[model samples]
Target: MASPKLTWNIALAGECMAARPFSVHDDEESMRVINLLRGADLTYAHLEMNLAHSRELEYPNRGDWLGSFMMADPAVARDLKWAGIDIMSVAHNHSLDFGPAGMLATKKHLQEAGVEAAGTGLDLEEAREPAYLETRHGRVALISTTSGNKPNEWASLGKGGYKGRPGINPLRASFNYVLTKEAAEQMKAIARELDVLRQADGSTMGTGLKDNEFSFQMPGDQSTRGSNVFTAGDHFEIQSRCHPRDLAGNLRSIDEAKKMADLVIVAHHYNIADGKRREKVPTFVREFAHAAIDAGADIYVAHGWHWTLGIEIYKGKPIIYGTGNFFAQSEFIRRVPYDSYESWGHDMDRLPTLNPADHPLHPGLDTHNEAWWTSALMGLEMKDGQFVSMTLHPVEMGRTAREGTITRQTGQGDHALTDGRPLLATGETAERALGRIQRLSKNFGTEVTIENGVGVIRF
Candidate 1:
């Protein structure tokens, strides 16, 4: 008997966060600090808010953060299983928001549920490993990475590199005021004394001070005596930038997996998509995607921006700028009072100029409004390794709690609260969603058409 032939169906890419409840109290200060330290405070805040709202609606309502979205909504995992999605990349910034414990839990859940997750691990060795999947047609490798100055610091699965920490290159910040002429001489004397001590230690103790230890002993003196002496006017920027070396290391792991697979898919959590205010794409995105393609990746998918952006073809490979939100189970609907216009559909507007009277459901239209947003996403796609096709599928984020009952959309638009089931766009709303995509694509030099509530963009 001969071995069976193999076939791989699909690889879906996007972002997922640990679910947190919404905070009614203002927490901008704490959030800002977290954002500065971590690259994704807004996402964490969004999770916080959504979870809070969900709890209130669920009753017995003692508030507690759900830790990870995957845990909160098993339906999402179920959907992926049903869709035949075998692997996922978890390299986004928010992957570390709930901390290492949460990340491990999420990864554990996915594995037990039979889904493969890559881009993070329990140690540097694990973080640098790739997730491999095998099918009848061929094998597939999924790899992920986060962007910014401190990717390792935010690494949830491994030992993090930070100043005064046990990881890799640590980030440290300092300031040194210029010394007076006399002060400089005094500092030089102290340095001479330290050198004498170092020599004594080398001879007697048989151990010399490490370069970094020596520098830390007299930072001010060193700064004053250096070719570029520090002054009050001098400013130093000391962000712990993610070294390409680290990225390359992770890529190497993926490459190893690639050797065992027929296709390689790389997913990153970064802002590849420019917002409405910017016309041109970012240089980093273009450069990085091209680098990955040149390094032998078949597809490069990135998401961080809340909306979909552009698609570019590099060296005959497809790079999707952003996929927007996919199955985000938001809790916005629960925050607003049911009697308000938001709950009744008071905000639906087909044209730029929205009229409350013309669009009666505008006030109550939350997820319905997002349906149009999701439809607009279909306008981004890649075909035959070129920037050729784009399409959007309007997906409601959550599963219905009960059958045959109408529910409202959450702020994240992840689920319908009534039965906790995912909702699909329908009727006039679905039609308009298709139309919106058709119209938006015009600006990008593409033509979009919709049939049966599906938007297809022709290049």
Candidate 2:
């Protein structure tokens, strides 16, 4: 029989934080102490406070962060659809930034605008369920999960909530920890109690637990708890180690999704922001992406770091570490500078050279504001079962053909040219961007090449 034709175009993965405009004066230096505190608090308290203030001061009428991006240019959303993105994963840390109300509004807007969203819902059950698409090829399922960094308060399926409800996937959590005393004892007692109940029922009690019983019990003491005690010989404790690439929950979701679809795609918001050359890829990325491929995922995409990171191909499947910013067009927010010692600090200015005269898109005095805009746009390509190619479209925040167009360019592909002025990143700018990708990928044993201002990662 001839092979089935794949109906879906592609699945784009990346992070789009709750949109809250900050003033141009909100620079890294201005918020250094706050950011340091934010790092110390893990809750992103300082960042949240700043976002809350921005919402209150800059967007009083908007209600939440969703309004700013929603009311901005429609062109970015239009371009995303044009780029063949049929589905999106909103399970990142920022999904609930504007609270559940903002998340729900985002979901509603995307759905109304014709895009499918996963990883959040009105309640836990809804959030756990995958978004099904009936494509020409076959049924496609998209599932998403976060690092649980966002407040659960904003996580729901109803109006003003994220995509899915909140619930722990036992299978995913099993790989990372052992069972606790309370959980293990609880499961043992439950099993004994169930046995007593079964005896009382006298309904042909079998020697072993039925598959249905196993399925039901597996999530509780039997699976997560049982495995924890049996495997680790200790009580369960959440792992403190940071692993960006670990895909435990993602893989489990994919396993369940595979039973209901022709193919499974996993999207996540992972943080691997050291941006330096190293001998090995971060432990989390390696474990998760590799495990996902082993579990039969067709694609694995992650985004959290604000810039494009790198890509890796494991067992023929494409695992994109970070796609940078897909539709991030929010300006007026304070742009935090990466520490001066960091390599990322070099490209703060839109100009390629140290001097301003050589770069036209150079924001000059407003370098921090333009830097974020200049670093967006990195797309993926896949054909059949293999990832074929990748492209980077340089985007700028400015007026488009239409009044609110956040215009992007495929390396000078279109748009009228200015008066013989040197374009941004002609030489030095391209080198720095590509260099960052290369340096970051060094730990992963991956080779990335920048051809005509586009960084390409090959397996």
Candidate 3:
């Protein structure tokens, strides 16, 4: 007799910055989205922002306000639970924005609201661990990690068993510029000077004064060719490799989850490219996703660019490059650090008077500007733990007017906190958004059928 056929539905969405204020009466659009989530046996979402109940800044703003150091209201966790999100990936660039306290607070609030979180913890090992959700249909496991993160945001293991440092799961990478022979020589001279000074102080890390192109050193290479920085020929190359320890740790976690759960989902946060354009994915991302599938991951979800990327099916597993933002309510965030304004050559007071459009670098008060505002929720149906069908439910993340009133308002515009929410796209909006997915996925040879404004994968 054939094995028992276990059937289940799973829904995965992009960044879920659900900063909107909770209300007793939710809008029709919000309810519609929530009902769709409820239809799935397991729903996974990316918790892009930390849930900080207070408006306090634990670390300096650092003047890097371009999608860094973000926090959200803790109350939003309750709303996420109400939305029927089963599990969330808590690892991202902003995971450690406010420090460990803030990160743990966000996790606590999410758990209290009945949502399981993964990709962050009290220490490195904990952060790399998987989060599991037991459903009537099957047990679902998720291992989450981020490719873009600050060094300080990386969790650490305490020496001598003291106490493990708190932080997020990090996938570190390196960059090297390729230049002509003449320019490479000049860089080597400078590197040598720096190396001499450092060696005088008993340092081992190469100053990059020793190698060029073919002679360039790899990170773990013990030979003298290794350099902290090096020069090559032609275009710049980014080492998209995951930190060795992190890669090993995550692979182990995936193996563990595979044994412990019936359905394994690996979620990653990586934005190596920019804008709403579907750029070539970094090599390391592809390697990691493929490795996860080989390690028994049934579904791979990657997000962070705030725009959708191409889709690939590897070994019968689905790898979604980028899912964009599911619920982008950044405009409604209650507070901003002082340095965020200082970086713009202005103070906090100037923010109120200046429109986001006028700011040199800002997500803008309008959330629906680019493809960042357009995204889709992936719905998968599995039979006997085998992929059967997948659908893309295109959604518009914005606000609507109340009757004939103007769509724009002071703080509550089309993308305000209370107003900002994900709504199913219909009519032309649906046509355009779903059509974009078609074009983005075309390169991967994935064809999708648009029916009733929803895109279905040919599978």
lDDT of 3 at 169: 85
Give the per-residue lDDT digits (tens) of candidate 2, residues 1-459.
Answer: 543544233424344432332222235542432232222101100011112222322222222121122222223333333333456666654445444554555555555555566766666555556676665556667766554352343343344553455421111212233356566556556857666211122234332333212212343333221212121235653332333322444455678787777767766554332233222334455566677778877777666554566667677777767655423433322332122112323464542333312222212223232333333234444455566655433332231211322333222423322121012233444455456656766655667777876666544
- Which one is best on lDDT? 3
Model 1, runs deviating above 4 Å: 1-13, 16-79, 148-152, 156-243, 271-280, 332-391, 396-453, 457-459
Instruction: Put down candidate 1 lDDT per residue, 231-270, tens digits, no spaces.
Output: 2223332112233565566557656765666667777665
lDDT of 2 at 156: 36
What TM-score against the true fold does each predicted structure earn?
Answer: 0.52, 0.52, 0.83
For model 1, where is the 10-residue window of minimal lDDT?
A: 40-49
Give one clash count per candidate, in the order shown: 52, 28, 0
lDDT (Cα, 0-100) at 444 in candidate 2: 59
Model 1 lDDT vs. the true structure? Answer: 0.43
- On the 0 to 100 scale, the lDDT of residue 147 in model 2 is 49
RMSD of 1: 15.5
Q: What is the C-alpha RMSD of each candidate to the true structure, in Å?
A: 15.5, 16.1, 5.4
Q: What lDDT does model 3 reach?
A: 0.73
Q: lDDT of each structure?
A: 0.43, 0.43, 0.73
